[model samples]
Target chain A: MISVTALTVSRGERLLFRDLSFHVASGEAVALTGANGAGKTSLLRTLAGFIRPDAGTVTFSAADPAEARAGHLHWLGHLDGLKTGRRAREELAFQARWAGADADGIAAAVDVLALEPLLDLEVRKLSAGQRRRLAFARVIAAPRPLWLLDEPFAPLDARWRAALGLMMQAHLDKGGAILAAVHDPLPVAARALDIGAGR
Target chain B: MILFRRELALAWSGGGGPLLACGFFLCLTVLIPLAAGGDPAGLRPIAGGVAWLALALSSILSLERLFERDLEDGALDLIALGPAPLELVVLAKAKAQWLAVGVPLALTAPVAAITLGLPPAQAPLVLLSALVGSLGFALTGALGAALALGSKRGGLLIAVVVLPLFIPPVVFGAGALERATNGLDPAPALAFLAAWVLFAAVVTPFAGAAAIRNAQG
Candidate 1:
């Protein structure tokens, strides 16, 4: 579903990676592992089109660039991007509508993530793990063809992490692809791409 | 459509934005007379100018929060990847803010003029000219907020960036009221103020979106 060639990413005067290449096909998952400050997040961001590469092209073979960016991919970053003043349910529903999800999709995501109990609580009042769970639910709420997760497992307990692994496996079972930046191993089988090796 | 409503709800979530801007205008109007030694005759000639200046300054109060909060909280990244063009997103945010904050300042301009000792006969012109003028200020202020998105001192930077852009509208809006009070034709000045707003409405979105992209990078 995605491909890149000779990708070079730099931060200011420092070079993070050079001459990098990788691909993720449907029903596949690519685990990105590297040392701290090894540009895993930067690479995910580059693929998500948030940062322009120093040199290379990111091609989504089946769709135009704009369409691929608009609804085809789902991104989970560190901040969760949630409003503290709103309830968990309100936040999830807004994201669902924004991503073109219907009622059943939202319901299934809530059920899978076990978020029904915390839906009425405002984001500010939720614990860190609960917030992380809610953020992941946003992705499940509107299942995109491609998922770009930057450090998706942080702040979760063992059970939630295992649940996330199961969720990722189910997504792959449904022919979805995932590219995740992580320090720990992913739950499903994935081809590991170590960014620090070539440097 | 969801984003627009979301912006409006966010703006009013804390409380009513218009109520505070209106209160700010009232306090500013009352201050001008005291600053001028409480002479009614002395305050009349510059009442329109004082009212326009207050409106311009008050509009800046809410602008620094426009894109800064979203940028800090990671919302900008998801918003950038959304289906709508970034320019439309920027426009929706600015328009929602104007409805929440700018309209009340304009609605209360005539009261400020009255507090500053302007004759009641010219109240309608004061209100109309200020209405169009504040929209111009809101558009420019949105652009300025985007430009200063991640700066260390974004609030001060916004004030510096937008105050210069506000000069033409302030001159035209204050001039329209000045002409009406002097019993001269106010059409040309009011027309100029409206023209400035129309121009700003067209150009601000592109510039604001570009600034947002730059800040995100």
Candidate 2:
């Protein structure tokens, strides 16, 4: 579980949000709803420890800030993080191992994502939805308590989008926490947090 | 270990690998005699200096991408989230750079030195100094690369930041070869080169990690 108190973040001379406070408890998904230029991604990054907040505190109940960042969460940002030169299998294996997943975990992820046929191709050769699926596969391969997703379903087609919704439901069922930044409705049930609305 | 292996593979297969640096190094060495006139006697005195200069420049060739690629592709974010501390990740990357880029250039340095009229008797010292000096280059180069991440003209920024850091190793490595060429004791200079490498190894990981974290924000 994560909590933010009086979180204020600014970029350059512009203030994105101020005095924002929210928390996502276990088995919950908090969809961040706001217009572009709002502090949704910034909030996620702040919690993930990528951005230092101008003012406020983000705390994880189970672990210290550093430990929570290092091993407790999955961050799926806009970029897929796959190396263009690497084979899909190579990328998946490396990411899975890097996340401390066992071989069985990787096998299960491959099965769920239907990644077997695309394993040998270079990442650049994969289609957009395929690449997005590959990106989401790492999250499945490694079980983390929290996922800080920025537009989790952006590039996927309808079928994959629905599939990911089901996956999110399963994750919530297992007591994981999610803080996602999105423009559209999340496939599963989620409490909406409107950033910058007070301002 | 997986991170190290992945870095090494990326260094080798992507962005022309060690081949590009080696080619740039060889070309620089070859151009020296042509530009200065083909007089072995004239070139011999500065051969060590020229080779060291070429080595320094070649080391800079691949540094621009060391951290830039990861940052641009978002791998850096995930890397920071991994179980290893960010400092360890920086250390692994620098170590992999030494193995991938530094070692190949070190192996090719003796040949370049000898071709530039360095005495074959001093070839072994040239090889040893280059081996150690390139380690310094790789370590400091990673720091420079990390510092220049997300900048508009990152390659230029990396060169500006890294070339100054190269001065110590270049001085020590070239000084070692010069001493040997003059039939003096080269041990002290070689020791200096090793010390520079140790200093770089000590300072780069923490500094580079900080730079990386700053870039993330």
Candidate 3:
């Protein structure tokens, strides 16, 4: 659904990547493999429209890139974006609503993530893995066409990693696309795009 | 609506939001009498000006973390991807700050004026000017906070960027109180203050949204 053509991104004086071109069609998952500081996250941020590329263009199939970034994609970055002072339920509800998800969608996400028992506790009290699951719940609650994940399974336990793999499979089966930045192999099969090799 | 509610709740729950500003304002009012020698005649004439100054400074107190917290915690990224335009999101944040902290500071302005020797009869003018002036502060403060995002010394950077923007509102607010103290019409100055606030309200969203986008990049 999205294509990048000769994309070049730089951070201050250093160039992260240059002349990089790739595409992800519907019902596909592409794993972005790279060494540290190899521009995987930068590429994701650029696609999500947070960072403007130094050169070249990234064009989407149907919607304008900006609109697509705003409405059609889910970006799960390193940070959970949960406020420590807020209850877990409040965070989830706010995120779900902010993403335009209905109450039924939130309930289904909660069920899939097994978030019921942890709903009442404050976010600060939850462990990192729980917080990560809570963060992932936002994606499930809101059905976006594209998923831009940065090390999506980094904080999850083995069981959750497997569960999240199933979710990704289901998402791809339903005509969704995924571009995940990762060091290890993804649980589900994906085309490996080696950013480090692109250098 | 959800964003506004979330910001309001966050402001009240942690970091002593409104209370901190009011306490600083009261402290400034109390210190003026102590520093300027406790004579009513001397303090009375300058009470409104001093109160306005304190209000402006107090408004700066809670602003350092306005957008910085969101940026640091990665909420800004999610916010960027939300359905609302970035300009509206910035406006919502400033509105939330106004409701959460500015309103309480406005409420405390009159008390601070009276403490600084302003006549109780003129307290309503102090309250009115402060209400409008604080809104201006919140808007300009959001711009400042957004601009100062990702900087090393964010708090100081916000004050440096915001205090200059605070000048016009301070002048208008203080002038309104000064006119009332002299028994002339205070409406003109209050109108000017409101107009300035409206201008800030209009400009801050666009400018602050740009700053937020830059910071995110």
Give per-residue CA lDDT, model 2, range B1-217, as digits (tens): 9999999999999977699999999999889899998888899898999999999999998888889999999899989999899889998999899899999999999999999999888878888889899889999999999999999999999999999899988898889888888889999998888888899889999999999999999
Sort every candidate by TM-score, greatest first: 3, 2, 1
- Alpha carbon deviation, residue B198, candidate 3 (Å): 1.3
Query: What is candidate 3's lDDT per residue for A1-199, written digit by digit as tens?
Result: 9999999999999899889999999999999998999999999999999999999899888699888877899999998789998999999998888887899999999999999999999999999999999999989999998999999999999999999999999999999999999998898879999998876
Segments of candidate 2 deviating more than 4 angstroms: none
lDDT tens string, model 2, A1-199?
A: 9999998888778888888888889999999999887888888888999998899899998899999888889999988889988999999998888988989999999999899999999999999889989988889999999999999889899999998898899999999999999999999899999996934
- Residue A25's C-alpha lDDT in candidate 2? 96
lDDT of 3 by residue, B1-217 (tens): 8988998998888799899999999999898889998887888888899999999999999898788888988888998899999999999999999999999999999999998888999988888888889999999999999999999999999999999999999898999989988999999998999999999999999999999989999
**Residue B179 in candidate 2 has what lDDT?**
89
Model 2: pairs clashing at backbone N, Cα or C within 3 Å: none
* Candidate 3 or 1, higher TM-score: 3
Candidate 3's displacement at residue B181, Å, is: 1.1
**TM-score for each predicted model, relative to the true structure:** 0.97, 0.99, 0.99
- Shift in Å, residue B161, candidate 2: 0.8
lDDT of 1 by residue, B131-180 (tens): 78888888999999999999999999999999999999999988988898
Candidate 1 has an lDDT of 0.88
Which pairs clash (backbone N, Cα, C closer than 3 Å) in model 3?
none
TM-score for candidate 3, residues paired by index: 0.99
- Best candidate according to DockQ: 2
